[model samples]
Target: MSRVSDVYLIAHVEDDVGEAVVTGALEAAGVLGKGPGQIKQHHLLCCSTLDGKVPIVRQLEPELHVDGHSGSIDELKRFLPHLLLVREGHTSAASGQTNVGIAASLASYFGL
Candidate 1:
């Protein structure tokens, strides 16, 4: 099998249909994540191709009030344009949600 290095972006969907879309995108792009089990809150993951680096972007729920957090979605939106988006679903963060997106983008951008 040949593995082509490519950046991956992930976003969490609210419904089964959304999940299907995201999962299909990730699988097609060869991107994987920490899985849903490790996700205590809602978030998204974007990854670059060169070195398999990942960054996690937390999606705030109205209740979590993630906007109040140090790094909110608004902050992330500022950087979204620079990233290649992908979709993924898993059961745990251990699968690679925390740092996949940032790593992937940096790697691809720097040609690492």
Candidate 2:
């Protein structure tokens, strides 16, 4: 089996509604299978455009084994080493933590 690298990009939605939009985008892009407990099993890369979402992403870092998180593509691109583009939304009304899980799963699948 081949290992895949998990990569996730987060965007703030117009309101709190962005969480679903972002999640859908990630899922559509092939980032999925991240439940709650699986968070600690893989490496994660997270990118977001919302300042408010940063804290949420940060909170998930330890759980997902997050290697990097950035608010801009430039920062994420430069710092992440490997990059994956996800949907766009502003601040998730629900929770963006799942994004980290998605990233981790993808990374593990791709061996990144």
Candidate 3:
């Protein structure tokens, strides 16, 4: 029988609130199962944006497996077709880690 591929939707949050949002979404998505293989997630945070969410996804040499190849989200999309943008919230000029229930709402929207 053919193997069923897993779906991955990453939620890059700004702070604790953001992390909580993502955690809730993931849990609500019905318990994450093991992927086809080990998938290492690397979160790169920057301050260029007001919310401090990095737009680029990078691969590290240290995390590379002999059978694995380096590629961006666009490249990965070729293999994993579905893409979902769950949540996106911005912090106010003076607020720290604004309440951005991004992933939670997104996962709900997608019927996760």
Candidate 4:
């Protein structure tokens, strides 16, 4: 891990997705508001579309948004001026992207 940044999660999930999201995934990401990840804010938007995250990002107004989901990157890029696409193999089903600010992994994304 590199220097901890104010991590935030703007996830899109359905209410009945089952399991931890009810109370665990965020904690595992060290996003308990006071933990290793030092997450400043987190939101679980119950929706199937990646575009659901657009409003959250707009409201937060962060300088940069990081995401690996290709479809999401495409949607978010429209609203966010800068987005870091962490390419870790698991990309969106839409297409295998060849352009974007891609990084091999979290560490690489941070230039660690």
Candidate 5:
């Protein structure tokens, strides 16, 4: 197989329905293909954490407002694999919360 030229890591904090919807969309868009020269898509389920099942959507809880802690703490841990790629120079960048943001990131990666 050819080396992957790009990889999209999705670390969404949602229930099964949401995951299924996202997967269906990705698959329909051909982003989930695993062929020789396709951009790879990695799906991560983010409902587990050291702090127990801290649903990422609840990161804004007042009780979770600890110093040196941001809302993305759990997300960071969940997406650590993708972050490692950036750190190791395998990925250029990782930033996105919406389709537009993700599209912009991808465009930047491809010099579009």
Candidate 6:
């Protein structure tokens, strides 16, 4: 987490996730650098609202945005500088100005 300028858990509420559960999961994952209070909880769109997260991603302007949604990562990578898609059976774009990568899980990706 220290490798990046900033991080936030911007998940769509309807992602079948309750805020408390999300906070607990993040806390358990040890990814909440500053703690759950620092999370930017936004409740826009459903779990599949890929583009709905664009604004938060844009505002944060992170060097990399890691997400489990392949489609969102694919599209957001076009604008964001770097992206990490955390899922199985996927690869970054072969060629593009944006930088994209893949990871099997958050623990492995961050070496947590």
Model 3 misses residue 34 by how many Å? 5.9
lDDT per residue (tens digit) for residues 1-112 in model 2: 1133243434556644565666556556554445532222232233334555445444444223232343433333322333333333322121233233223334453456
Ranking by TM-score: 4, 6, 5, 2, 3, 1
- Which runs of model 2 end up more than 4 angstroms from their true locations? 1-9, 34-49, 61-112
TM agreement with the true structure for every prediction: 0.26, 0.30, 0.29, 0.63, 0.38, 0.59
Q: Which candidate do you rate higher for TM-score, 1 or 3?
A: 3
* Tens digit of per-residue lDDT, candidate 3, span 3-59: 332223344456677766665655455343334332222221222332222133222
The sequence of per-residue lDDT tens digits that candidate 6 reaches over residues 13-32 is 65455655766676677655
How accurate locally is residue 77 in candidate 4, as Cα lDDT from 0 to 100? 63
Model 1 deviation from the true structure expressed as Cα RMSD, one decimal place: 14.5
Measured with C-alpha atoms, the lDDT of residue 55 in candidate 1 is 35
> Top model by TM-score, which number?
4
Computed on alpha carbons, the lDDT of every model, listed in order, comes to 0.34, 0.38, 0.32, 0.59, 0.39, 0.62
Put down candidate 5 lDDT per residue, 18-59, tens digits, no spaces. 767777776787666676555455532334233433343343
Better of 1 and 2 by TM-score: 2
- Among all windows of ten consecutive residues in candidate 6, which has the lowest summed lDDT? 39-48
Candidate number that wins on TM-score, 2 or 5: 5
Off by over 4 Å in 5: 1-8, 39-104
Cα lDDT of candidate 1 equals 0.34
* lDDT minimum window of 10 residues, candidate 4: 90-99
lDDT tens per residue, model 4, 1-112: 2134444565556655632464376566665545453554344434455677676777877667777676777776656656777777633322333334776676765556
lDDT of 1 by residue, 1-112 (tens): 0132222234445566776777666556544444332221223443332222223432321211111122333344444333222222321121133322332233343455
Candidate 1 segments whose C-alpha is farther than 4 A from its true place: 1-10, 33-105, 108-111
lDDT (Cα, 0-100) at 81 in candidate 2: 32
